[model samples]
Target: MKLSALLPFARLLCVTTLVAASAAQAQQVLNVYSARHYPSDEILYAGFTKKTGIQVQRVDSDDAGIVARLRAEGAASPADVILMVDAARLWRGESMGLFQPVKSAVLDAAIPATLRGAPDAQGASSWYGFSTRARVVVFDPAKVKREDVDTYEELGDPKNKGKLCLRSGSHPYNLSLFGAVLEHMGEAKTEAWLKGMVANLARDPKGGDTDQIRAVASGECAIAVTNSYYLARLMHSTKPEDLAVADRVQVVFPNQASWGTHVNIAGAAVAKHAPNRAGAIQFLEYLSSAEAQEVFSDANNEWPAAKGVKVNNSALQRMGGSNFKSETIPISAVGGNSLKVQQMLDRVGFK
Candidate 1:
């Protein structure tokens, strides 16, 4: 061929190579919509990027906000991964068809079956719980005996009347707990339990889990329910006030003799319309790794969702949660009960 002909061919090859390179670079990016607002979670993302060389771009919001945003965006959404802090919210997303099922051996092998979404016919899961927090009873030892508030059922006992503190019943944390209780106790009994709790309210429900803990410490209430992590934060705090609050309250992992304590999760899923599905799945797998599990425990005060992963959080150990019994109920079932539980809460005026 003549030099002029060869020159055009060479230019065409160069342009094609450039375009392929650009496309490959674009494929290395992963977009995440996260409901976990904790600053400590930054380490989790950074670690994934370091390991895979896949850059992560994240949008942070509360669980409800993230779910709403995903729904609003629908098929046109740019979200590749969705990280939510509650089992109910994850279930809500899954029920709404917001997540595409993922088939990952790493996830299946690492996480417990109860901590992940139900498998589809093809044996793929729509979501996986990366970390867990037990919903525990916290009480003032002076006013409430350890045995008195040892189980969830005791919370609604008339003997403990005018001594309970709770957050809004409609909150996702409460919804998940109530849903789990509904699974164990059945609907009619669950409704009655909620009514009893309403009658026992030390004050109208109004506060976050941490606030509930402080209310116990300050004597505003004798007994309260809170996620383990919230209490762990106080237990691990450097401040004297926080330590005092931790010291003033005794935590009980309820139902240890029976079905076990209700545990909630912070879970993740691949968006249904993920533009980078492979990268999103990779991120989910990374979250189940031993290293990532440890970070979740140490930084966020949550327990590792992956089986056999060890955590070094002193707060967890101090609270005797290292070997506490947790309910084996499938989290999906608990989340599915959210609506029914909420309605029961409304009928009982549980706030």
Candidate 2:
């Protein structure tokens, strides 16, 4: 078995198969508004179609755009489920009361208490996060010494100032990272880190992770903070662009000793007024099963939210002993503080 092919739908949890079957037979369709653009997701949809005969209507778009569109759709929003990356966005949706609360033994039992709900009763179950991603720094082993760096806090040190590059602080990934920082290190430490990190930037923060990777590879910068999956994509892609990026950078898992790494998720939630609550619950359940979790991880380097999903490939395990520890604070803290993070970024001239 090819390593990535180890996960399939059958071995994974389908949540509520009988519920899905009944819903499918009723001529109803599940309308999904997703910010995820993985080709593997299509396989998930295809499997769902084949097994239950439910039409999975998915409209893929930027997470923020879809949220805005859904909000604009107001009472007329036809979306059954909403999915996206970055925890702050999900927290925003919950803060705005955009998604509704849903309870299923399957979901509650399958998801850890931490990932399934918001911080409190005020924002409970607005949504649940599933597949996960981590924000870590990577570098070229041949050009840089990996032993010198460990935590995100170290990236801003004066000794390595000019050698580092990062994407814009305004991006969701940074915001979520900032949120995690604020939650763990307090606002003061986070502010200090941001100020120092911003000052240390090898160049003006202006592009996506891909851009940062390019900068590192082209000798424009020696270190770049990026998601793990970007390497997987670049290494596996037939595209010349990805190939070039892969040639320049080597993946380095950050904070291996201090706290493993900072992580966030790509997950889903049903609408508050969903007419097919049962079906939506079924869908949520499927997302938690070992099958979907494995497919997500092996397919795109995404981590699974469910407890028992096999997520560590050799490359991931070798970096750190898969004893990953996520920030205890929920993303609502980040969502609530996103504006604060922006203000701080502006004050520090992170532009």
Candidate 3:
């Protein structure tokens, strides 16, 4: 065919190619393998996309399942980020080499140094905690006076024997608390505390933090151990009975006179083979921003890891007004010592 006759077809081909290229560029997505099952997380993801035009796709699973899937996928994994509900899970993922060291000034400046893991040789961090929850005490004011249960060590007092309620010893929340105690009080003291605390249980260790709160409300136990956020959830519930439970219990920030409250975290790490590295980092930084922090803290009844962000939950407000000191021990230390803490719990028969 003559040049003039072929010109229109050639032009059509170039236009199609350009359109395909543009579509590919516009289709940027960040895949998140998340162990956090909170419905509120949708708002954070949507807000990130609205700001940056990068879509987020999430696969929700238990921490172990998420880790196993990532390992199975290896370098070809589609996960751009790993969002977890506990420091131990994040630490486990990093230790297993599932995360890449991420460097973000926003993350570094907004999050406390202890919340983010220590920097590697090149000054990048493998994981960052965006929200925190204190493992605290809840007591029936009718049965236990506030001043009488001021510290964690007080829970083991003989006067409180047969009046304490707890979740299973194997739960990560309790494990991390035990880990911190081990870090501060050493093996012998922690072992002794565990023995006494176990002996004090009103019933066999059972249920989640929420169950412990309910037990306190019913006066089945005069005192219980639970995450601060769980009490926040109870206080904020639309159901009247849940609110009643909140009213029945008085909040206590344990160990305030000594080490401060023990805290665990909800955190994220960039997948080692993220397909959209820039978008992943941008999303991670967005999660660290003050706006996202508030949303997360309010939704989960947790505290923001970002400096200067306020805790908006009423339960938290009633407890300490957002300015109480938390334990200053590095969170990584708690995560690292988790195994030993579990072993001690098992040995002490903290069922």
Whole-model lDDT per candidate: 0.93, 0.75, 0.87
Best-fitting candidate, scored by TM-score = 1
TM-score of each: 0.97, 0.85, 0.92
Give the alpha carbon lDDT tens digit for every residue of 199-232 in model 1: 9999999979999999999999999999999999
Clashing pairs in 3: none
Off by over 4 Å in 3: 1-27
Give the candidates in order of TM-score, highest first. Answer: 1, 3, 2
Candidate 2 overall lDDT versus native: 0.75
Q: Which residue pairs does candidate 2 place in steric collision?
A: 12-291
True lDDT of residue 119, candidate 1: 93
Put down candidate 2 lDDT per residue, 1-351, tens digits, no spaces: 764675565445364686677766654688888898888898777766676567798888997788788878887777888887887788788777778887667777777766755635544476787877777777876667887555788777776787889888889888888877777778788788888887678888888887788888888888888876666666667889777778666765666566557777787989755656666777888888887777777776777788777655544554342466655566556667788888888888887
Ten-residue region with minimum lDDT total, candidate 3: 312-321
